[model samples]
Target: MTYVPDPARYDGRMPYRRSGRSGLLLPAISLGMWHNFGGNKPYENSKAMIHKAFDLGITHFDLANNYGPPPGSAEETFGRVLADGLRTHRDELIVSTKAGWQMWDGPYGDLGSRKYLIASLDQSLKRMGLDYVDVFYSHRPDPDTPLEETMGALDAIVRQGKALYVGISSYSAEQTREAARILKQLGTPCLIHQPSYSMFDRWIERPAQAGAPVLTEVLGEEGIGSIAFCPLAQGLLTSRYLDGIPADSRAAAIDNPFLTADKVEVRLAQVRALNGIAAARGQSLAQMALAWALQTVTSVIIGASRVEQIVENVGAVERLEFSADELAKIEAVLKG
Candidate 1:
């Protein structure tokens, strides 16, 4: 079989927003390969989601070095998908991958050191069968590494033509300011920041102090765009838990590190309340959550285990706005 992309992919069904004063405009929702694209999964299953996402005008596919259960498998899966047919549309895509985590055994294989960042991306490009990635990220701030070295590695990657743009993830507001400043001096302005943000996880929206700027404020002041990760809070914001965690849910997976059944039980009240609000708005809880998060970030990275999930998640764009009372109610639920 062959891939014939939906000619109407750009027919205004999806909106593209400017990324923090950059020349790039990313789709409001980008697909993330943090799960379900692993080697252990059925190849056709993963490929279907990728194809479906692109048809829905999702031009960005986000990945990280340690994304798979076995690590490095997600990129391999994506690479295979591209080799199948998606590679022909490579120029129309924004393919990104990250480093700054424990990828290999040695000390030189992890963190923000110039050596690690460079080597990690090289391996990533190799795994994805690409000469370069559209965007490369630091993934996480290295507490033991100097900001200059990390940002410098990003700059050098751009200079090397291996990465068109560079970004950071999980850096604090002050840390973001310093990282952006260094990248600016190096002539490669930070393109974006990936942070953990959602209705349940709102640290990125808070000020460092009583009157200090939040991470988003720092990003706004620096003209850096952001794409929020974990915006669904590992399925807690979805209808999957509104009734109760299913046996197949992430929370029910005994080995799943992100969510646990016990935690889901504790938060069932809030989840059900949010679900009620979502129903009133004619949207699924996941859709409402994504819509709400989109109001603050440039885009929300969505993960999926099936193609149907991608379709439902992308439908969030259909109703991206909400009333002030809805926001107030949501705030009440969260606070309570």
Candidate 2:
């Protein structure tokens, strides 16, 4: 049976923050339906995960038109859940979807072209059974397409009331600054930038003397929101890699080109050290990684394969803030 949220259901632990300079705000621990809500997954389990997230006060749900292994199946499945379970709370939800990579086989299936962006958004809306998305993002920068054209399409999407706000993902500091400028000029300032960040990954701390400030600083200065994905370094921050890689873990399940068995061994050392730090603070490694992200960025977008994982993730927000010494030690562990 499908489950609907209780009218009095609420969890006060998770926090919310404004999206950059925009009036829209998102939950501190937003959930991403990128991995587990796919075609081959169980419908009941996906529904339970979504319900559990809502119960934990995760009001934001991030999705994409091409998330499933077969592509577009995730949105379709989420549509089923929305239609059956969460439709009553639609107004209380912040739903977002993006389109950039590739989804189908055709000239109009990928990239940041105006045609592709608009078409993908339409398909995404249809699959989610929604009239408008809270946030529609250009999934990635289209180096081949002019930034103006791409941002123009995003602005148009907002103007048409198809998306309340626009965002960009996987963009560098330079690209994020340029996109923010174009969007601001168009009167629809880019709302947020989603990048991959974690304790094991510190790309955001690049030397500012070499170029402009890091993207996180740029977004904070430009008044654009910053939400990090893969905050657990694709589950490396969790205890799953502490002993060894389980067959069900993301690195073992998918053919990750970046995270090999050897890299897991290297990251295991980091995880062990970081785990010591988390234990010192009386938090799990997962909580420490998540709290580290929330302490660093405006929001941290997390993905979960089960309801229990979502429950554990929200606990990070209870003690989201950390101390100077903790941050210093985290930096040291990251450097090692």
Candidate 3:
């Protein structure tokens, strides 16, 4: 069967925002191929989610060199989807991938060194079956590698036509400034930043200054757009654990250390308190969290497990604005 996308995809169903001072206006919500698009996961489900996301006007699909359980499987999954239906609409999509974490075993396979960054991207392009990605990111700052060497690799990736633009992920405010300066000298200005942000995690919202050098402040001065990952705090901000954790929930998965059952119990009170506010706003806790996240980030990457989840999450765009009273109340709960 031929997959036909919704013609009304761009019909005001979604909103776009400028990424800092860049010309790119990304969907307020993008899709991240982090957990569910792995080789061990069902192929049909991953393909369905990607199609549904595109039909909802989400042009950006985020990936990384080491996204799958076995590593490199997510890119392969995405490449299969592209060939299945999205190949013709390539120009309408913004596919991005990253490196800088432990990808392969051995000395030259990880970190932000020139060898790792370049090799990782080249391997990523091959896995995704692409000549170039719309955006390429250094997954994290390399403390062991020279800042110039890492940023220079990014600059070279752009000049060599392997990436249309460059970005950084999980970099601190101070690190961002230094990298931006190096990239500027290399004639490739930083385009965006990918960070973890949610109501439970507000590190990026700190006051920006030379002494502190908060991320939000540095990005403003550097003219870089930001996309937040884990905006739902690994499902902590959602109603998933309101009544208690499900048997199959991420928190219950023993292999996933990012979230734990004990941690969920600790935050259950705060989650319920926040859920009440979402109810008053006539939205689900997940939707409200997505809207609130857009308050700081140019875009929030929605990590979904199924097509129904994508459908529900995209509705957050319909009620993105929150009144002053609402903001204050939400703050009170978060602080409490």
Candidate 4:
């Protein structure tokens, strides 16, 4: 069947939020293709998810070059979907890709060096068959490279019109401030900061190695948007593993250190406690978790293994406005 844009796509139900001080507005629920959109998986499923996202008004689609079982496969698969399925809707999509972690077998394959960042974006563009990305990120902080060299490359990319805005992920507060300073001086001001934030992982609020809060108050102070990934804590917040690991779940399949069998039990208990509070407030545990993030950050970069998950997540937008009593109850349960 030929891809047809939704006839009522702009009927205006999905909510949009401003990203910090930037002029751009993003859909409250942005989709991230971190896992699952791989070559091994059926492309039609991923295609359907993207279409469903747009149908529901999810304009932003987040990606990384290395996001797949074999690495780079997600981008390649997404590229085909973009070409064959999303071609006509390109103008309606806010696509982004990042480079920082290892993608190939050499020194230049990683880090925030000028050569690596530029070359990686070029390769990512080729893989996705796009001339440019809406946003390009440094992925993570490079301990060795000078921040100037890194953000400088990002500034050049923006100047060259390869990326509309640039951001960083997993950066310490001091690093975030320094990078923002340089990027601002260079005329870009660090459009956004992507961190892994959820109910369980609160390190983003803690002090950095230099004794300064890693996120501090600078994100809000600088008016730089914060897009939190793993908002469901790698599915810990979801009820999928409340009983035990399902054979098809990420924890059951990848054996990623962050989500293990032991964590499943521990997180299940926490999820159950949180679920009680969510039930009191007339929301699902997943919905409450996502609402909490949206209440705190500029955007929640959520991932979904199924179309149902995305639908469930989008429903959370309606659940975003929680009362003070509801927030207090959630805090009490989390503390317990």
Candidate 5:
């Protein structure tokens, strides 16, 4: 059977926000390919999720060179989906991919060196079966490499028509400021910054300068948009752990190093407290967590393994507004 997308995919079902001071607009909730689209997962399931996301007005799909369990497989999977289902509507999508982590073995295969970034993006484009991505990101800052060199490579990629825009991820405020300045000088302003932000991870809210604002505020000042990852804190903010970690959950998976039992235990109390406030707001814990993150950033990247999860997560956009007392209660819980 042939797959045709819903005719009304963009019929005001989702909201879009300007990416920083740029003309580009991203969905309030973008789909991330950080997990669940790899070779280890079912292709048909991944395809279904992608189609559902698009049908729901999730125009942006985020990817990275090192996203898969066997790195690079997610792009390969997404490439097949693009060619099979999304080829005709490419213009309506904002596809993004990143480079800058350890992608391959050799000396030139990692970091922010010009050689690595260029080669990595070339591979990423090939894997995704696209001539150009809407946005290409330096996955992280390379302390060993000059910021000018990395930003210059990004500018060059845009000039070569391989990427329409350039961005950075996991970079500190100072590094972001410097990179944005360099990109601006080269006539290619930084489009967005991908940072790990959530109620559980509030590093972005911490003051980066003695008397200045936080990193998110700094990005606003630099005219760079922010898309927060881990907005659910790896399921901690959701009801997934309310009754204790399930054997099938990420925290209970032995291979998952990012989320462990000890960490969940440490934050369980806070999570429960926030859940109470979420109940008062007439939203689920996951929804409130996403709404909280989007309250500050331009958008939030959500990873879903199933179509139902995507449906539930996108509903967060409906209840984004919070009362002053609700906000105060959330702060009190976090500060506890």
Candidate 6:
């Protein structure tokens, strides 16, 4: 069957926000290709999720060089989707990829060095079969490398027409400030920052002992937008674990190391309390969790393995508003 996109896909069902004072407008919820879209997963299933996401007005698709279990497989999979289905709508999509993690073995395979970034992006472009990505991110801050060098490479990538905008991920507030300054001096403003933010992980809201501002505040002051990853805490915020870890769940999967049984047990009570609040508000736990992250950030990146999951997650846009009392209740639950 021909994969034709819905004509009414952009009928304002999903809200778009300006990415950090930039001209680019990203969907409130962007789909991330971190897990489940790799070679280990079924190709047809992954394709269905991507198609479903676009049909739901999710124009932004985020990926990274080291996303897949085997590394680089996710990009390769996305490349197939682009060639087969999304080629006609290329201009309407915001596709992004990143580096700065351990991509390949050896000295130049990882980090924010100029050589590694440039080469890694080249490989990423080849894997995705695209001339340029909408945004290219240094996936993490490289403490060993000078800020000027990493920011310079990002600026050069923009100038070379390889990436329309540049960003940093998992960078500390202080590091973000310095990188933004350097990119500005280099004639390329840092457009956005990708940080891991969820009710369980509130590092971005914590006051830095070094006197640096919180990450969200710094980005606001610097005119940089933010996109939060792991807004659901990797299934902890979802109903899938309410009863117990399903045998097929990510926590039970041997390949996934980030989420384990012990980790889920520690947060079970908190999740149960949060579920109660979600029930009272007439929304799913996952939806409320995403809305909580979006209360401050510009956008949230969602990872889905199934088409139904994408459909349900996109419903978060509908119930984004929360009253003051609701906010306090959520805070109380987190603190408790």
What lDDT tens digits, residue by residue, belong to model 1 across residues 1-336? 988899999999899999999999999999999988998899999999999999999999999999886799999999999999999999999999999889999889888899999999999999999999999999899999999999999999999999999999999998999999999999999999999999988999888688766898899999999999999999899988888989988899988878999889988999999999999999999999999999999999999998999999999999999899999999999999
Task: For candidate 6, write residues 1-336 as lDDT tens digits.
Answer: 678998889998899999888999999999999999999999999999999999999999999999886799999999999998787899999999999999998999999999999999999999999999999999998989999999999999999999999999999989999999999999999999999999999999875776768888899899999999999999889999999889988899886788988889888998999999998988999999998899889999999988998888889999999999999999999998
Q: Name the top lDDT candidate.
A: 1
lDDT (tens digit, per residue) of candidate 2 on 130-239: 99999999999998999999999999999999999999998888898999999999999989988888776667757445866687778888999888888988788888
- How much lDDT does candidate 4 score? 0.86
Residues 1-336 of candidate 3 have per-residue lDDT tens digits of 678999999999899899888788899999998999999999999999999999999999999999986699999999999888788899999999999888888999988999989999999998888999999999999888889999999999999999999999999888999989999888999999999999988889884554787899899999999999999989888878999999999999998899999889989999999999999999999999999999889999999898988898899999999999999999998888
lDDT of all the models against the reference?
0.94, 0.87, 0.93, 0.86, 0.92, 0.93
Clashing pairs in 5: none
Poorest stretch of ten by lDDT in candidate 2: 4-13
Q: Model 6: runs farther than 4 Å from truth?
A: none
| Model 1 weakest lDDT span, ten residues long | 205-214
* TM-score of candidate 4 to 2 decimals: 0.95
List model 5 lDDT by residue over 62-104, tens digit each: 9999888679999999999988968888999999999988889
Clashes of each: 0, 0, 0, 1, 0, 1
Error of 6 at 316 (Å): 0.6
Q: What residue runs in model 2 are displaced by over 4 Å at the alpha carbon?
A: 6-11, 207-209
Evaluated at residue 220, the lDDT of candidate 4 is 79
- Give TM-scores for every candidate, taking all chains together and pairing residue i with residue i: 0.98, 0.95, 0.98, 0.95, 0.98, 0.98
Cα lDDT, model 2, residue 212: 65
Worst 10 residues of 6 by lDDT: 205-214
Clashing pairs in 3: none
